[model samples]
Target: MADDIREMSFEQAIAELEQVVGQLDSGDVPLERSIDLYDRGAKLKAHCEVKLREAEEKVEQITLDAKGQPTGTRPAEGM
Candidate 1:
């Protein structure tokens, strides 16, 4: 489920969030709907944050070590 959510584009995430907000605002949905919306919203928020972090890391030219783990060093500075 998380992997599927992560595959969604930013636009898709925003669209889903809008739907969630609408459902929450309507106050007509059952408890299950509210819970589902809340869960989806949480996932969307996390996905957006991850994407933003990755973009920032890329712009900063961050690189990973041989094991594909971040070296914890900034770009243009030796690891």
Candidate 2:
């Protein structure tokens, strides 16, 4: 259900998405079943994107000196 989807971690969502892709690609599912799987795939894809965007927003890049030592960290974007 939707509640279960929300609880899935990024890795879990991606794993399920991969399984869905494999099933869809196999072309062995009944039309109705395939439709259902496709819908779930869409939701999983959206969830994964949201997780990635959240991680991206929190990402920071380490500033290094000419000697290749990490000096500090700064936001990965919008600096």
TM-score top scorer: 2
Ten-residue stretch with the least lDDT total in model 1 = 70-79
Whole-model Cα lDDT per candidate?
0.78, 0.94
Per-residue alpha-carbon lDDT of model 2 for 1-79, expressed as tens digits?
Answer: 4778899999999999999999999999999999999999999999999999999888999999999999999889762
- Number of clashes recorded per candidate: 0, 0
After TM-score superposition, the amount by which residue 32's alpha carbon in candidate 2 deviates from its true location, in angstroms, is 0.5
Q: What are the per-residue Cα lDDT tens digits for candidate 1 across 1-79?
A: 5788878987787788888888888999899979988998888888877777666656545579999988775554332
* C-alpha RMSD for every candidate: 8.8, 2.4
Candidate 1 wrongly placed segments (more than 4 Å) = 60-79
Candidate number with greatest lDDT? 2
Residue runs of model 2 more than 4 Å from their true location after superposition: 64-71
Model 1: residue 61 alpha-carbon error in angstroms: 10
**Candidate 2: residue 36 lDDT (0-100):** 95
